[model samples]
Target: MWNIMKYVCAEGIVYRGLCGHRYADKRRSVRLWVGGPFTHQIHAVHNSVPFSQTHVVTSPPWRVLFFGTDSFAEESLKHLFASSCCRQKAGSAVVKLLEVVTLPKDLPVRRFALQNQLRVHDWPNVNVQDRFDVGVVVSFGCLLREDLICQFPYGILNIHPSLLPRWRGPAPVFHTVLHGDSVSGVTVMQIRPKRFDVGPILNQCIYPVPENATAEELGETLATMGAKLLIDTLQNLPECVANRREQPSNGVTSAPKISTSMSWIVWEEHTCDQIDRLFRAIGSRIPLRTLWMGEPIKLLDFVGKFHTSLSGAEAETPGTVRYDRESDSLLVSCKDGRVAFRAVMLKKRLSALDFYNGYLHPFFLKKLPRQQKKCVFGSYKTKESDTPLGREAAHKVQNV
Candidate 1:
């Protein structure tokens, strides 16, 4: 007489035995039956089951709520929107629903969300009753409270433009360029309440900073790179969350928001490279400023270091100014080297040629002896000396 028995394996496979004796499979994934000495036959019937007949497990699509404000954030939103549309069409959606939350002011993310017809929720007043699987924050300025963060199943993921523990504030890209860092990258992390960018890292990709890359150029590159990374993180959300690690405490740094006072050119303290980096970092938003004959002048169109034709006298004085006719740029001597600018603005904007003829020429011709006939910048000081001029200056600066 034969006795029949069944056993289930960890891989969800079932095994049946005629002799009631269990044997381990070679791979250890399942158990097989071995006939006893008195048994007539032994069989392994379910070993070659077709994949179509077996049950397959798959992760469901995610419902995502995104928070963003600027152009940098816009890139990630675009990628997520595209990915959702493509996946839905393929009938295996990665993101089932997408929505955005932004501040009241007109921002890039808000504009893109409106233009694309995606749902937009005004920030601090967002409704979380729709039951989102995850939340994404990119360049979003508002702080999320603990109660709000608990609404999402996967918590919130932030696409920070810098490697964390370093540059933990509102201006990572600007600080990266300003400090002349050789390498920078984007990081995907889980957001924690009451802090910014102090979250566990999910993924990171290093990018070598291009030669003399301006903050604007670097920002654009990182923005695109970050968008792709964000999608990749979402694709394997569970795995990323499982393997996430905390940021190290050794390299902690802060990237404070750029201010107008940071644009001042102190000839005695800064070098050509330092000034060049400064201009690349924030010159587009706030022109480099300096005092000329007790009046404010804004430097524009930085043309980099003047490598050739340096006189001993000009090199001796840090604030000495000279016009390079060959390059058609106004060269200003810094602590160790000379930097060139294509234009300046005092009462009005003027080209290098116009500035040389109007302000520099008359000053050199009349102010000092021929041996000391040099036009200098930052020679005078006022309480608001470092401030940039004009009504169109940044609101932050204007208020200050």
Candidate 2:
């Protein structure tokens, strides 16, 4: 008797259901359960055996637990529910067909953290002595204890957003984008009771990061790839579980958690390549904040290309504002070269053109008191200035 269960915690409520197997032709997913309204609907359509009706000699064939935060977890549950449609659709429908679960604006990160605990590892009386088939962890921020890991005879598989053996810590995407890695991909590792992303790589999906990929952009892309990778790895779990491997104790790089201080644009210490990576890594989602001319300016969008235009004596000082105007790009100098920026954010407002225009005057004259060259494309300033440059920049935006 196999009863596949899907568990999810949302809005202080817990949703659990039996997984359905009819979705796949391979029968690899003996049963797939998704914990949400959409999953419930899919269960109905797929005719999944009701948990009450089954008289099983043994436990369910497979039970998958999705450990995620409020919106992140709930949305993933909806995605699992929607995965039934993936077999029928061509190309990667996995990316486009996710069910959006919106959370309130005031939702605290603390509450979100609690929700994940309740949904994934908070099974009241579950005994680890009785082993389960497999456990797949995707984007769930907490560490799994040995008790939970032992319960899954098949072992726990985690979808980390970096190539294993590298960036094996909390913030892989940020490090990858900030450091400018030509290749970025996901690694499915066997989870062990350890500090952070230290585990044996069982499977992996590799991809390249574009020159202009930002952290937010790369994160979303990696998240989607992670979802698919989880499914693929889970389908092959029987084999992956059979061959257990431990992570190499040596040659491990730590990707420590991020802080606001770490994210602030440090124009002086970074290099041209580092700044280029930062511009791409910060992406549109998480606007990279920097103190520009004593006022905080959040970069909304930007472009980096080889520059031959500004090659003179001023190249000695990188991060110097070489050109700032209504033009689509603002050029800045670096130790070796320069880069141009376009999209930007002023205060909390997100607009590329407005941000450029607002800082154009001060940037041109190097009148920004707080401005200091950290690298080619980075300058620091705090958010306190009466300069009408922001207002004028806001008013001067011509096209989107």
Candidate 3:
């Protein structure tokens, strides 16, 4: 009887009685579930068919319009194009990359599409004459309007860097690393209008953020993970069609676009940990600028710590740089703690020692002044008239 009911359900009668009214109420979703709110059970049951019946694709390949303009999105497209499921076979709803909606011609994504012989249409100049099954957007650089999103059978799908409802906007990768999060991941979700990333998540994949991993490294790692996850989710698209749940209400956070202001390391204002994170998050994205020997220098790498040597004492002038012969690193002062500038760039990239020897040492004395309660930044006070370093020392004194 169970086998008979399963066949009856497969024939579609069981759901008509149980879900017909609900399906009518939600016109957006074509397939209504058998178990109502518990969507995955029956669908996953069918999707678990024997490998011998692999040819049996329950639905035809969805007509997918890809919208993206970056390497991250390109990675997802590569998987989508190369997957065996995307081959020209007789499976129902197997994905077909009908066309791409990308930025102008010179961009990497557009060039990739053209090289692959895929049709490229500018976003606002969307070719809507032919209907589309679904739209997949990944870092497309702009939001789609409601009418544009509504044209597809299903609305847009976004491949986001961080898990949705957390890190819910652009530059999620930066914020995740900035906050020193232990774990971060990618989310493929419905792209809603007015707000970005506020949609039902189709799937998610998580990976750990190892200590000291830069934002660029983490983003690339997540992009690869996201691509594989998106492919698997698409392969099981039929099961996932009606299975999405709304984003959880709690634990929401925004990852706004990275700004130039975020690139500055405010040693006097920020703790060592915070300044270290700032450099790590935006180091690759933008140059971290700071005063080295009172001359503006771009920071390449930094190391932060509680400064156990200054256990009972405190950092006197936060931006003051000190020489640590033990590590061959340039230690700088931060509020409550200390940090090291491992690498920096002025006209060219160089290690802290190289910068110190060529520029900083030439300007200031070899030894920083000895102190008792707090680390003192005293050097290059030639006379009553102040040089650049002297002026900086004077400013530090006033701040203290």
- Could you say which candidate leads in lDDT? 1
Task: Please give, for residues 1-400, the per-residue lDDT of candidate 2 as tens digits.
Answer: 1123432222222222222222222111233242221232233233233333222112222445444443323433544544434433654332222211122233332254344332323423234433335556665566777656655544566778888878887688888877778898988777767556676666778999987777777787877777677666655654543343556666567777665445455545565677677656544445555545445555555666545554473535555554445456656555556556665556456344554455554454375444342323334423324222354332332111
lDDT of 1: 0.77
By lDDT, the better pick of 1 and 3 is 1
Report RMSD for candidate 2.
Answer: 13.7
**Error at 391, model 3, angstroms:** 15
Report the Cα lDDT for candidate 2: 0.52
Local accuracy of candidate 3 as per-residue lDDT tens digits, 299-327: 66666563548533362666666666677
For candidate 1, give the lDDT of residue 97.
Answer: 84
In model 2, which regions exceed 4 Å deviation? 1-61, 70-132, 266-269, 283-286, 289-296, 305-308, 311-316, 322-329, 343-400
lDDT of 1 by residue, 1-400 (tens): 1222233356665433322334333333433222221233434434444222222112446789999999999999998888885445765567778999999889999999999889999988988873677899999988898777755656789999998888889999999999999999999998888888987788998999997899999999999999999989888986676567778889999999998778878787898889989999999899998766546678988899888856584546777787879999998888888889999988799999998887668654786667445577753222444333333333333443
Against the unseen true structure, what C-alpha lDDT does each candidate score?
0.77, 0.52, 0.65
